[model samples]
Target: MPRNNDLNIILGDLKSLFSIAAVLMSAMVVSSLLFWELRSAAGFIAGMLVSLIIAAAIHSITPRSEALELKHAIIIAALAYLLIPAVSAIPYMISTGMSPVDAYFESISGWTSSGFTMLPAPDSIGHSMQLWRSVTQWIGAVGVILLMVTVLIRPGTSAYILYQSEARKERIRPSIRSTVRTIWKVYLALTIISFFILLLAGMPAWDALNVSMTAIGGGFTLYSDSIGHYDSLPIEIVLLPVMIAGAIPFAVLFMMFKLKLHTMIYDIQVRTFAGLIATGCLLLVAQNYFYFYNDLFSATRYSVFQLVSAITSTGLQTTDISGWSPTALLIMSIAMIIGGCAGSTSGGIKVAREIFLVNQIKLWLKKTLLSKKAVIVIRLGQHKVVEKTITEELNEATLISFLWILNILVSIMLLANILGPEVSLSNLIFEVCSAQGNCGLTTGIINPAISPLAKLIFIADMWMGRLEIVPVILLLRTVFRGFGR
Candidate 1:
């Protein structure tokens, strides 16, 4: 007795859900093969069958539409992104026997590319599960935007709206699909290049593969100590550049690929991103020289690695940053929050927004210095930004930044109430920054033995951070509206 339109909506939702399940099943199959775990293989098969059944049911029940509305697209994207991670966590729970919350935390962390893990050590988890973790980040890095552009978006305003909502406003090509394919090509090429470099740097094949995936901010390390497990300067050097590359905007990479060196070098956002990295590195190096490690080379190595890792949101660490001075830790925390450029795998507020906000502030100062009637326009790169655009950008950036602070403060209080006040506020802030930035580096607070509630909080933070909060909010709104009913 349901209307045909209502049935179609339900069917579309089911299809999207099944699609996510299929992705999880595929990952599971890969994990099963890697570990040669029969039980996991069975799980993968069962998952696939279930997904196919749902797909079949949806296909049978509903008719296809020529185009989808913006609301429909947002709903589909939100559900797909969230459900993929949730379903993917099942295998981790089964393999590691981690409590449901811990497993969800790990899965969300991986999918969000946050890299923070509750696992005790590298050897503690099976090879297959670790690989699965890496895969989740790698997939999530490209994101639902890439998928929509490739498979859904066509010419016109709908595509534009979807692109903006996806937080990838920068277009690399005339066609959205072409842009996505180019981005994917660059991403995969970098992955391959990183893999070979790591192998040459003396990592074993499996280790190289895992580290290569993680080096680009995919946030899955094969070992517990992360890049530190290799203990090789060569490996660190190899990874450092790759992490930087990951942080660079994909549109810039496409320009570089087209041999437009000026576009790559002269880009305002890229230049600012590079400048921030250099500044952060210098500060950390100075801190290390004065307090941590007096050795010049050791200090520079750790400083560069941590800076690049945080800036890129890669979260792979060569040293325990918890032992660093409070000043150094604070600097790194801020770097993590700033993150990389737009149109990249890295997360956080992003360098582009930071540049925009700074420029807006400068314009305001200029106006204040001039007569009250004077007009001022913000400038970024070669373009003069409109007042409306600047205002919106500032408002969005401020809201997100304030929300992040609030979340961090609440999390710290929760942790303090549970873990005691002995834990330094600085360390708590560092962990919060790491998780929210999707940097994956930790202050040793996230452990297998932590309280379940704490783990859930971190997981929620990672999920919110990765999606940049909007999609999750929309998903919640949809649930409250009872569309599923």
Candidate 2:
């Protein structure tokens, strides 16, 4: 891989990316007009032009064909994530009086598909902004880099590097481009189906469109009350499968599309996540029934929806959990921490890493107990992982999960000092995990009134989680020590 060639190609690729983002924002221009929001339309126009200017400035270097190093991939991904939100927040600033920091925070939240919000009320944001946010969530969930590479970059070493830098890997096709195109098709198809289903379930057309777009992208509500706004069982039921689909790895869905159910069921990630969901739902139901809801039906209803929301990092809410017991909240926190499958829109440490950790641990224990001549391997279904891959997976998983938990703990301590005395220890734990896991369930601690430092802390957590921790570290290291090859 020629380092200079990699640099030129990635730069050229990013320039094309920002241009693409501006083109997509055109829909929001029309969206603003449809909603009769002249101010927002102007903001969208301004934002589009500014992004195009920035793209034009990125360079006219003709990309040379070469492989991109992991470091370059990380740098490009981290910078792209940071830069786009800064530009996209313009509409929020112009349409409403939200300060720069507030607007950027909201924009990044949508960009990460982590739906924690500072809005005091839904009416506070224009309907056009709401539509833009939902659209951004859909794009962000699909991944900024994946969208870019699929559109213009050809399949190659650089393409896969850019794609996986978004915290996703696993090819659904022979090449990165094909896989992404298939994923885009699947994602859009699901969004359309979800939109119609929500409409059928009694949501207004506009509301259905927004909710389905966000929900199918593993984002929560544009409304203040989240899923609770409707309180309709049919709506809840329809959304469960959509959220599940959103959180499922596109490869898994691709396998399903190919009718490979037998292989999927035996996959370690599938089994482990299913076990986690079942246990979480049961524990939550018992706690809610015995302590809060008092009725079996009511407990089960909230338990299923909230548990799926937490595990999928979807953040849709049917009821508040503020009054729930510490035990109940802990269960929800655990679900959020585990989150959905790797290569999915949802966040947290991911199901693939969790199973990898468990398998490695089992392999270690078995090795210590077994005879010297014994043969052993960690198997996922009919496949055996090679030792080198196992070592890499373990190293990556342990490192990222450690940094992830560290970020959560630090945020908790900071918030404990900043928030009210009445804010319990459990709620603080829940809040930080929600932010860092990119799981947006809240205990009411997030607000525009919160101190800037607190807001910044949550903002940083979302960025790190969405980038999967390592890239942020790589970027910070580059800033201090200078860029490394």
Candidate 3:
């Protein structure tokens, strides 16, 4: 591709993203208008204008090119993801009269699919504003996948390579664009189905709409207490399947839809994801039996819900896990960190990576017992994984897991230092893990009462976690280089 053409392609992507942002802003404005929130409508308009100006300026100044280097693609992806949240926060600030930091924090949390809330309560916020929050998550979840497919996918090869960097390597279709469209279609269909299901379960129209959006997006509901407010076991049961559906890999869903039963059954990632959920649920149930609830059925219900919530990164809770035993809390935290399978709406390191790492370890142990003349190869499913690929995947998984541990440790110490020694260190770590994994389950630590600095730290962790850290790091590197120049 010609240099000029490559730049043009990059510019085109920027323009396209800006156009999408403008559309989202318009949705917010229209929704606000319906709810008679003129202030929010105006803010939406202002945000759109700002985004357009920035996008146009970048497009005009940047050279047009047909192709871009992988580095440029990574830089652009990171910057665009960061910029959108910052711009989206304008309406929140204007509508809710929140401080700039709080607005940005909320916006980042929504876009990153982290369910943490700094708002006083959902009831206090305007209907339009609440809708905007849910809408932002719905859009963000789809937008993240779309951006990965469109801008990051190089020509001639499927974008699976770029997808892997985002911890989503599965392909639902032959082409990146097709895969994106398919996922969007499935996601939209599920959202609609979930909306009606909630309505049928007797939730009001507004609640149904908001919950559906959050459920399908693998996001937390707007209510401060989440599903606890419903006080309806039927509603909770209805939401259970929807959250699980949201966490399922889109590629596997597509295969199932296409009647590829064997493919669905044989998928390594899907089986592993299911197994992890089962294992986590069993442990939590056992804890409930020994401590919280003596009734088996009641204990099982809450345990399964909590496990699903953490594994899916949806953050909806039926009961408080803070009061649970230490072993239970630790198990749930681990579930949060592992999260759902890759190529799903859920976030975190992902079960696929975990499975891969475990299989790699087993292979390593076997290799130590092999004879010198033996030729052995590590395999996943039907594919023969090269030693290099195995090593690379293992290294990436280890690095990410290590960082998660380090971040949790740092956050605990910071929170303890600020909140005093009375705070439980384990609970603090759980909160940090919840925010970083976008799991949203808290041990009652995150709230309006928390200090501003701690809130900001959690917000930053959410953003870094959502982007899987690399893009944000690259953006910082770019800034430092520019300053040096």
- Candidate No. with top TM-score: 2
Better of 1 and 2 by TM-score: 2
lDDT tens digits by residue: candidate 1, 276-384: 9989999999998889999999899899898889889999988887788888889889998899988898988898878867877887888779888766677787788
Q: Which residue pairs clash within candidate 1?
A: 122-224
Instruction: Put down candidate 2 lDDT per residue, 1-485, tens digits, no spaces.
Output: 32456457557666777888799778889988998999999889988998898887776545544556767778889888888888899888888878888888888988888888777675557888888888888888888888887877555877788878887778888988888899998788878989999999888898898898888654547577888888899999998888888878877777776788765687667777788888899999999999999999999999899889999988888888888888998999988888888877788899888887888888888789999777777786569876567778999899888988888888888888888687899988988888887878887888788888888889998888888888888777766675544
Q: What do the candidate models score in CA lDDT, each in turn?
A: 0.77, 0.82, 0.77
TM-scores for every candidate against the unseen true structure: 0.90, 0.94, 0.91
Candidate 3 residue-wise lDDT, 306-408, digit = tens? 8898889888888777888777888888988898877888887888788778878877887889986666678787778776788888988887777777877
Report the number of the highest-lDDT candidate.
2
- TM for candidate 2 is 0.94
Off by over 4 Å in 1: 1-14, 27-35, 53-67, 123-126, 148-162, 481-485
What CA RMSD would candidate 2 show?
Answer: 2.5
The positional error of residue 157 in candidate 2, measured at the CA in angstroms, is 1.9
Q: List the residue pairs that clash in candidate 2.
A: none
Superposition TM-score, candidate 1 onto the true structure: 0.90
Alpha-carbon shift of residue 97 in model 3 (angstroms): 1.1
